[model samples]
Target: MRAFAALLDALAFAPSPAVQVRLMADYLKRAPDFDRGWALAMLAGGFDTACVRPAALHALAAERVDAEFLRLSLDFVGDPVETAALIWPESGTEPCPPPLAEVAPALSSISRQAAPGLLARWFDRSDLPVRRALAQLAAGRRVPGVTPRLARTALAAAFSADLGAIEEAWHGQAPPYGHLFAWLEGRAPHPEAVAGFRPLMPVCPLDETALASLDPACCRVERQWSGMRVQLVAESGLHRLYSGSGDDVSRLFPEIVAAMEGLAGVFDGVLMAACGPDGPPYRPAPPEALARRLGRKTVPRRLVAEVPVFVRLFDMLFDGGEDIRPLPLRERRARLEARIANRTRLDLSPVLAFEAAEAQDAPLVLKPADAPYLPVGPPWRVRKAPPKTVRALLLAARPGGTGERGPDYSVALLRDGAPVAVGDAPCRLESVERDRLDRWVRAHVTGRYGPVRAVEPALVLEVAFETVRPAPRRKAGLALTRPEIVRILWDLPADAADSVDALNAPVSRPPTAGRASRSLPSGSR
Candidate 1:
């Protein structure tokens, strides 16, 4: 437990990725196998069952400390679990803390009623850093800068194993990963084969200057669809859907899973929702349409019908258990087109002529025709026009997080001749500019809403964004994508700022069918 806590503390403050990987690799190399496996699982956001609710932790803290002091500490810390861990009283004679191997299983099986007593005992046995790590684990939060991928990378580094093979063998295995550890230590054969997610290849923005250098005959162009990138795996009677980050989201989209019932291959594509039947002219729906179906534990039949999704096939990674990723892109595309012929819920992304694609006034993706499907590379390139800029009225200021020194500014646009809050400006202002805005906000406060302060809409800000999309859930009825403050517009009148209609103009086009065709079985919904 102490070693794991020390790893967390070191990882949180590691200055660089190289340093973080070194620290994690060192810890993994030295910790006991059982402890190492559990630590790895925690770093990968597993062990979700071993958690105490934030409200319960707060209640426990109030019982031990003064209510006023607890409230003040909470406001200062901004995290309830951290505040509770800091305010926990220390014992004069501390008992030796239990190992992670013993602690993990006990916490996993603990009931809500028994959790408080167990936590108190553990807090009494551990010091400040260990107590904080234990509290964070109980609250189901990973330390900052440590992601599942980074954990895998560190493990690979620790054992000097192939990272790609490790990733391919990782998904279906559970923690503590005894078999995985045995395989890493060469004490056992590879784990049983399962149709798990393969990491998706990354895409880099196509530099405008390099466009002329690309060979027209050696590259293929496809429209960059606005949807999530996903890998669909159907092999050996196992069908699953994975987000690009390797999360198993099979249950979230049952219709898509059912549509792939008989398929046996690994496919890379964009998963998107569309209106109307799942065939022929594929109308591309807004991201919000697909957003409605994500993150739900159970997909109600009505919601599934309302937001039907389909995958536009990009490339075939596996063809009937054969690892075809070593083949060139041209061969992969040929195999993909042949595999999904006359299939519903799956269709090939049509390839356009380079000149034709260049002439179209839309975003495009360019792929090298001869490159093999590598998990990590820049074989895919996207081309989008520069972001558009608009002048918006600054409406309010929200308090920043723990280490942020300045308040975050909320900007708005005119809708029906009234200012409607659209989103926050994430631009990091220069110290002088930040001070100026802070002074203005402090002087012109209107109303208070918790940590946010409403300010008079007397200032205009020049904001630049990549695109605008219809956001039905927002008061403005639209939302900006990747917006950042270009500069402050102190002289511009607030009334002269752009209206919501201005941002909505480009997105007002009627939904046109993309390269998609599919039909879902009635039983699937």
Candidate 2:
């Protein structure tokens, strides 16, 4: 428990990625096998055995400390677990906390009714740092800067193994990864034919400057669908669908798995909800429409029927048992077309002529005709333009954390002449601008909602965003994607900011179908 707490503290406080990696590697090298495995799982967000709720923790804290003071501490700290850890009265008992292995299983198997007493005893046996770590672990809160990729990278560095090979072998395996550790320590052979995730090939954004140098005939253009990027794997009699980040979501989309029953390959594609029922002339539903079907453990039959999904194959990574990722784009595309021929719930992403691509308004994905698939660094991407911007009024400001002097701003749009909170604008303001805005916000405070201050909606900001969509749950009945404050419109009046209708205009109508590319195989369409 002490060692794990130190690791969490080191990771949280370390600003440099190199230092963090070194710290994690050191911990991995010395910790017991089961403890390290569970630590790795927690760091990677793969641990899901939280038994205590935040409310229960708060209630426990209130019983020991003054309830009103606990509430005040919670508001100031902005985290309930942290508040509990800090305010917890030490019992001064000789600390004898259990090992991470025991704690992990106990938390997983313990009943909710018995959780508070057990947690209280653990708290009494722990110091401040260990108490905080235990609280965070029980609450399932991730430590800052610790990610799955970072954990894998640290493991690779610790074991002196190839990072890519480690990533490929790490997937589809659960916690206390005994076999993985044994292989790393040379006590066991490398796992083979393990039907695991392959690191996805990501793309660099294509700007007009780079596009101008490319010849149209040497490139292929495909409409960049606003849907989830996924890899469908069917190998060694195991079928799985992985989200781009490598989450095994095979359970969420069983229809997709059923479609690839007899297939044997790893295919890279977009998983999109059909605008209507599955058939030829398939149109992609808007991103918001597809979002409804995501993240659920089980899908109701009625919902599945309402939002049917299909994969549009863009490239083939593995053809049967052969690794074809080294093949050029043209060859892979050819193989993909031949492999999924006549298969339901699968279609080829039509290749478009340069002229045909330029005629469309939707975002375009451009790939080199001869480039090979290079996992983690592909020479292909969506053609990007400057994000659209709009003037929005500042509605509230949430106090920033740690060293930040300025508060985070929440901007809003006008609906029926009333300002409705839309989304929080990220802190991209220049230092001078931030200082000026901070001063103004401090002066114009109207009311308080915990750490957030309701400001006099007088300041206007130029908020740039990539997209907007219908979000019925938001107060404005809309949501913005990648919203960032470009600059403050100091002279502009708040009422001069854009309206809800103005932002809604673009996405109001259903998506229009693009002209099918002539290069697509006839059978694919």
Candidate 3:
């Protein structure tokens, strides 16, 4: 238990990735069999204990703490687990808590109603930080900022084991991982690669200067959708869906799984929702709408009905169990187009002629015709996003921001009747509007985290930016560069706020700056 606590504290406080890895390696080297195994499970995101949820803990805390005070504490702490750990009344003089191996299994064995008491008892036995870490384990949440990839990386670093060998063997396995330990310690065979997601062939921002001079015939440009990049790995009458990050989302998206039934081979694509009962029109839902679908493992029926999903096939890495990654992308796409044409819930991502006019409306993924698919890193494909502007909502604001022009406001573009933050910028509310904003911030704020304050997203603002380029930093797998608030847009309705895709749509001529800068006082829009 102490070792597990130390690991969590190290992971939480360590700012340097190298230091974090060293700490993880240190813990793995000393901890007991199943205790260390459980720690690995937590690191690799292997637990989905049907016991207590973060909600239950929050609910339990609400019963004992002052509601307003708790809310304020949550705002300050930036997380619920830490908030709970700090505020939970310690049990009277209990000895040290049992190791995570024992505690976790006990939690998992009980009913949902019993989870609170057992977890509370465990909380009482430990100090604040251990309680916090245990709360996270109970809720099946990862420590903030650390990634599963880093966990795998740390394991490789510690054993001086092959990274690829570690990753390939790590998938679809649970902890108390004696096999992995044996294999690492040279006592057992190298674990076989499981049928799962492959690392992405990352793309870089296009060099617009080189774009014009490059020969079009050597490349194939494809429309990039504002959707989730997914890998479909099917085997033995079942299919699994994984996001680009390699998290198995088979249950979160059952529709996609059913669509891939009977299909064998590895395929890559973007997951999108239907544009109504229309033919061949798959598009991204508003960010919040997609969030609702993604936030649950067993998606509710109404949500499934609300957001029908389909995949726009991107590339074929395998066909009929034959490795086709050695083939040129154009050849792979041709084969993918032919093979997946009649499959349910599947469509080919359209291949476009190298035309300047239509590039902005979608991703122009330029792949060399004969280059073999290199399942990692950039400089493999050049992606371009033409200059554009979006009508976004001023959803929230933060105090004392870190960005040069920031710390004042964060903006969100609307999707499916919910606000989603597109980017943060320096506040640009008009002098008259700023006064009203102060009052609005007080009355309408629902929650907050650190410097960021959440407000009712009823305000509209016009944001001008150079491009909606691909960036790993942003939630939508894209970010706006040089975004400036041109207007407060008080006249525009929140629901009528412009779509994100509108920024990517083709424009016949450049928009005039002055005419488009129409502003309204903050009180209305």
Candidate 4:
């Protein structure tokens, strides 16, 4: 084991990947059973022993590798217990192979006698992915003999060793499914429950079977919305919005905060493109209209006026004094609807009926937990959405200092050549530093810019932009257009006195935005 640690340290400091591979291959050929297995796995990109041990077993079965070599490899791979279950080589649901489990107690005894530094060395030398797999085993299996020897503190410390490996693999973000699963299984810390949103075990695209198994009557289906998921927290008079990644979007959607001013309790929903006079809705807008607003952070006055935002307020997890998450979807909705007075910003999401056969293909519609509703035969459910459309804007364009084009022109959706909804096109510039100038051109320019040309509402704009001024900071930040038409409420144009009343009016978020949020499953993005 000491020799193995030295080998790993040397390899870790190696200047070249090729050199590391050579070192590992040499170890596999010469080291003891445990070391060889681990070394071979290191040489291979995937670290799980399930892969390497199986290959070894196959070679032995084919008589490609002799019993002598296999025994040596097994020794080098050594007892899993020696590595503190580092080798966690599983052979299905049955007990671990006799050779491995037979040595578990001996290995555990050795680990108990070893010093802290030695234990650390052992962990460091093991294949990281193998160690991760072993962690799973240690967490699941309750080995009475081994468990007692390794005091609670020592057991806890053993678990910590896997963190580095896990973090290295996940790059700061928690392991997507496995980490959460481990928490649910009581292998890790109890998951932190936030005030507004619960850490949902989201149905991964891979979990099509589980999704299909969903009780349609118990769940409601809706289009996976785009845009980032936002947890709107307005407690007392303080308002703050957090992205799924925990980024503060407090200033991004001031209108939403204002819209939610009177509403009690925290809420969760997608922050997406809204139209009409008000702001974004929790629900998806009409698909056709939202296509134009996708990926847009900044909405110009004309577009804002035409396609403003309104909260769809689809599902409610909490009310002023109640935690309704445990309640069925139908019950939650009924309570939520009863409390919600703003039809413009909050409304009930409709459900769709589908049979079990339809369940696999179509999404499950989530409902309140206590509802007596059942699918006609199989479980059917309700889902809600709004319509959407795409439109291209041709704002003024200009060439930049780097000789690259700066976007200026834009177009809007129009019924009779009058701007109904407006959106800008994707721009390519040196960097974000040049974005302010680009935004100015897009927002203020009167004529067509760059490659952009005016198109009817029938033609949608495929635009890409970041949040320039989604939320208001100052009086100038509130300005969107002239006195003719204002899009947002708090950020009304100073001169638009006549339109101020209309600008203050409420609107709905386009259905596309809702759909976008679902598709993206945003978290603080």
- The whole-model lDDT of each prediction reads 0.80, 0.80, 0.71, 0.38
Q: How well is each residue in 1-525 modelled by candidate 1, as lDDT tens digits?
A: 999989988887776667788899999899988999888888876566455999999998888889999999999998888998999888878557778987777777888888878898888898888888888888777676667778888999999997877778888688889898899999998776499878677787787779889999999899988888889999889999988767778888887898888888999999988876758446767787998888677889998888888888889899998999889999999988888887777777889999999887667999899999996666588887566777788888887532333456788998777898777776455656777778888999999998898999888777767777777778997777767665676666678677888885533221132211121232231
lDDT string for model 4 (377-452, tens) is 1232323221122222332343421112333333332333334333333233224424443444445544443344
Give the number of the best model, judged by TM-score: 1
| Models sorted by TM-score, best on top | 1, 2, 3, 4
Error of 4 at 217 (Å): 3.6
What is the TM-score (0 to 1) of candidate 4?
Answer: 0.32
Query: Candidate 2: lDDT over CA atoms?
Result: 0.80
Global fold similarity of model 1 (TM-score) = 0.85
Candidate 4 ranges beyond 4 A from true positions = 1-201, 206-215, 278-307, 355-525
Error of 2 at 11 (Å): 3.5
Per-residue lDDT for 1-525 in model 3, tens only? 877877887776675677778888888888877887877777766665547776788888887789998899887886776788888776668558767888767755778899898877777788776787778777766665567777777788878986667765767566778888888989999776558566667776666667777788887777666678888988656588888777788898898888887788889888877645344545545443465677565888888888777888879888867888888888888888777767767888777778762446444777777777775533455554443557777777776412223246778776666676667655454545565656767787878775567888877766756555554455555656556665665556677566666656623232333233334443322
What TM value does model 3 have? 0.72
